[model samples]
Target: MDTTILIVDDSQFIVDGLAAILSRKGYSPIMAHGGDECLRILKSAIPDLILLDIMMEPMDGWETLEKIKGDPDTREIPVLMFSAKKITPAEAKEHSLSIDDFVSKPVNPAQLIESIQRIFSRRNDIKEELLLAEGKGVDPSLIKEYGALRKSIEVDRNLLVVLRSAVGRDQAGRTPSPDEMAAVRALEEKVASSERRIRELQELLARTAPPAGQQE
Candidate 1:
């Protein structure tokens, strides 16, 4: 399963630009034109993440976010809010809502991608730490496991390169074939599963490790 992302905004340009960027990066991007459209799409399928724009005609991003957070089914999907309006930390805190990150308008592609990557990377780290905390002891075999995990990450990075290439080709006015899309999707799933496995191994290692105050 590719990491599916939903993009919500009234601007066709933004939706197309983001879709192109994510598609090239091996993520499957779905678009919704407005708050109503977004909600409607959510009724059918849930995305792994959402990129929401704050300004729009009729219902705005803030209102859409509230609705999403209010609904149990959609609430868990991480949202990265984007806006031309300046956002303050206090405003974000006052919302009492789930916002994984915030991005500014006239979106910087590099910054946007970096932010998303950071969010997922941190999530993987936290998951690994939690797994370790729950373990009885660190596994001596974990060193080997770690090596294998690193190899998997390397493979994923290679796949990302392929995705980037495909995106570059598409940007030159060439459309990607179904086979290319399938390949990208497979790579995305592989990366996600590898990360999960790595976290589990990390937990096992943590559980088996000797306490700091204990002798070897």
Candidate 2:
């Protein structure tokens, strides 16, 4: 299947040009006029990658990037910033934004293709590395620590969803039943305890796990 790409730009010209280039390269490009539209599109389905313009009105590229990266659901989607602004290596280093690559505006088709290919290549490399590590039998302490942390994160995410749903129900004059409220409270306590356990497991792993180059 062709990889889906979401293109966010204020300029129709740039959007059209990018869509044409991506289509020619065998990618499926979906266009959004601005950051709000981009987010609305994401509500239905996330694209494989995002090509974000940095100079849109109302919500510029940087702000949009921040919003995307801040949300856990969207943070993993690779973002390539398409910008006319010259970004110094030092400036890019200082920025906390998780931009995968930057493509200069008046986009060069060759460079864009190369950048996208590199991103996918790097992703494959990481996947291979993870598989290799798993196959080698990761340290038991490390596994325990990671498993605990993952569980805690899942619990926290669930808590957020429940809280949001409860608020929505309340606003709709259909507040949660007493049993549901009690269940939510119990879940909150469980999440807190799980978080504490995860922290302890992390500390134990730090103390017991072998340092680099050490054997079991």
Candidate 3:
């Protein structure tokens, strides 16, 4: 594979061992002695994955991970941390840190490979979701551009129903003023606008789709 992995650890022996194993597995391994160097290297290159050791001094793996996720540029890169301290995914989630995987220190090669495969597998699942969405007669662009449009339409339609009920009478059973009727009309227009946009997007997707029998 053309995957590049970055190994960050204060221990030279650990870094070297992980690097050798990754290289033998057909991955390009980049080494950084500590969190500082890791950030410096990231300024120039973003690796496909990061294997971080949690026992570094001053700026430990958790700190490094926080910095990486805080920055929009590197937040999406998957991070896997290993240490003898036994960090679990549930524990990581409690701290609001997004760790892709965790492995125990004195790492077993088989387990390490399994963790990496799991991370890649999750990514593949996301791609499959997007493909399925596109297959359901929706434009990929509309999926992003109008991402919350459907939910928003649902909410507005519900409001329209409530407003219509209020138009004929109030909570005390009195006739609604002209302003209440105007409010109902406004909500009706909003619902129509969303429905019109959805039709336009569906039409656009149909036009852009390849003709029948054409190979992608």
Candidate 4:
């Protein structure tokens, strides 16, 4: 079955353009002009994925994403945010938004398609893990731990982005300011801590996991 993708953007041009791209890639696109409309559509039918724009009337993508993630019914659906405004990893970290991915505009067709495919592939892997655990009579809490680890990894990766941006030289090739350097150091420590936690989680899951072809 062709995947259904929900696109929420205030601009008709962007909505139409993204819809065209996804259609050619063999996906059905559902369009919403604003966050309210997107939430309304979601009440009746949840799409396989959502391509959301950060800027919109009455409700921005941040608020909309919060609502989606907060809801029990729609929280699992992956959302990819696209925007003309540069949303730095620092901002995303501060907001604590559970975004699957971010694509900056104007959108690159190949990158957009690749990101979408990657997300679907990851979700499929998680679903398979869930099925395996169920068959083996493993504790369901393990699956929840896996999901939490994934989110932590994503957050840390974004922090790395912020660190990179902070350390980058200015347009004139001048060195980063002292404040920027300090920020980079702080971010580095956070990323290191997160990486260590991620490793611990992976090892725990592996040790506790059922052996191949074995069922409890």
Task: Report the poorest 10 consecutive residues by lDDT, candidate 3.
Answer: 88-97
Pick the winner on lDDT between candidates 1 and 2: 1
TM-score, model 1 to reference = 0.61
Model 3 scores a TM of 0.61
> In terms of TM-score, which candidate is strongest?
4
What is the C-alpha lDDT profile of model 1 across 53-118, one tens digit per residue? 989879998889999999999987778878887553234334423566767788998988986886
Q: Candidate 2, residues 1-216: lDDT per residue as tens digits?
A: 779999999999999999999999999999999999998888887999999998899998888888888888898898887777654323343432366666677799998999788767766655564444455456655654565354345534433443545435345667766655665565566667767776775565445534456555
> Whole-model lDDT for model 2 versus the true structure?
0.71
What TM-score would each prediction reach against the true structure? 0.61, 0.63, 0.61, 0.81
Q: Tens digits of per-residue lDDT for model 4 on 90-172?
A: 55555533777777789999989998987787777777866765665556786676666665566456545634554573335
Candidate 3 C-alpha lDDT tens digits along 1-216? 489999999999999999999988888999999999999999999999999888898799888988988899898898887888643323332432366666777899988988787777766665664465576645567765453454446445544543454455435667767766566666677679878996776567555655456546
For model 2 the TM-score comes to: 0.63
Q: After superposition, how far is residue 74 of candidate 1 from its true place, in Å?
A: 1.4
Candidate 1, after superposition: displacement of residue 109 in Å?
0.6
Q: Which of candidates 1 and 2 reaches a greater TM-score?
A: 2
Ranking by TM-score: 4, 2, 1, 3
User: Where's the lowest-lDDT run of ten residues in candidate 4?
Assistant: 162-171
Would you list the C-alpha lDDT of every candidate in the order shown? 0.73, 0.71, 0.73, 0.77
Poorly placed runs, candidate 2 (over 4 Å) = 88-91, 94-97, 139-216
Q: Tell me, by lDDT, which candidate is best.
A: 4
Worst 10 residues of 1 by lDDT: 88-97
